[model samples]
Target: MVKINILYASTEGNTTSFVTKLTDIAAENGDIVVARCIGEETDYANETAPFVAIVPTYLTGGTGTGPEVTEIFTNALGDYIAFGRNRQYLKGVIGSGNRNFNVQFNLTATRYAQRFNVPMLFAYELRGSKFDAEKAYHIIKPLFGE
Candidate 1:
């Protein structure tokens, strides 16, 4: 069985939605996809099993006190990726941008993705509540090569 981890950190449910879509797609294809919040710890027997992280970008600069959501997952996955033997098991989604909805954020998420070397995908341009879920799916799907 092909197992995949879909981890996410979302404050306003935006990033959560994205991760949901990712998990759903992977599940539909017969992959054992696991989705969880950043704070939650999961047990995966396979160190090189595929993993994906989804983190949200906030307009404000404060990172939530707890492990910054994405960081927790990245740090966990990074260990496996750093070994240079698990390239196929790493992927990620960055929640940022949404111009039509007037949502703006610092985009620290992109940097996090870079740090882990996981493919990054934005939800939408900076805007206010005008997030297009379809667009987000399209953007994130490529990272999974869906």
Candidate 2:
């Protein structure tokens, strides 16, 4: 059984919803030993199993304020990802983005991915800002290679 840990840091629950579908897909295949969803607990120390971190990006328009998950995200990176010191782990990071706000978030995701050198996947919103659970699952289903 392949254990999959899905960690999320969501501002408006957009990413949270996306991660849920990913977990569902993992379960449907019956290959997942365990699929857990966590929020504000990205710290690697808190994670006992090999896991994947999925960060969702929300769209910000003029006079729009974005959600904040930096503290949780950075803490996890410091513990699990070897950015400065020398360390390595099997981890995957996937980021989801809104229509127009994706560019900035994509850059942020890439920076983090490059720093950690972990497998990274970025999913951009095809049409809308709010992600449909079922649609999201189908969109990312093929990416799991399952």
Candidate 3:
């Protein structure tokens, strides 16, 4: 079985709930999954397994055009990617944000994907739906050569 690691950040638990559902889906597909909250004591830089990231965008400077990522995510993931620690690993990115924010919606995930050269699998909204979970599963299934 392929091992998939999911690193995530959530301000109000929406992203956490979404990740939980995605984890269940990945497990059902027979992949060994490891889910870690951003601030948790996990060594993302040293991870050897392919992984996915789920981050949420928040309005910054009172403008939708400028969004800020959570410190927990930026601190951990920034160092991991900036230093090219996980550059050789296959990865995906998923972002969550409020649609009302318009231009800033899920932008954080987009940035992370570009920075890490990973695929942007899905940009889910607040409290991701069942469809998002299914999409996540489909994206990860093939990584195991299934």
- lDDT scores in order: 0.50, 0.48, 0.71
TM-score of model number 1:
0.50
In terms of TM-score, which candidate is stronger, 2 or 3?
A: 3
Task: Write model 2 residue lDDT over 38-140, tens digit each, in one string.
Answer: 4345433444445555555433343233334332333443344443332343365666565565245444345456667876655545222334544444444
lDDT: which candidate is best? 3
Using all chains and alpha carbons, the TM-scores for the candidates as numbered come to 0.50, 0.57, 0.79
lDDT by residue for model 1 (63-135), tens: 4423342332334434434445544566665555444324234254565567667666554443323245445
Off by over 4 Å in 2: 33-48, 58-87, 126-146
Sorted on lDDT, best first, the list reads: 3, 1, 2
lDDT of 2 at 144: 44
Question: lDDT tens string, model 3, 1-146?
Answer: 76677777776899889988887877786776687776545455565766677788754465544334233344555455454556556477888888887777887787788777888888888989878888877886676455
Candidate 3 shows a clash count of: 0
Candidate 3: clashing pairs of residues: none
Error of 2 at 45 (Å): 2.0
Please state the error at residue 93 of candidate 3 in Å. 0.7
**Model 1, runs deviating above 4 Å:** 40-48, 61-90, 100-106, 125-146
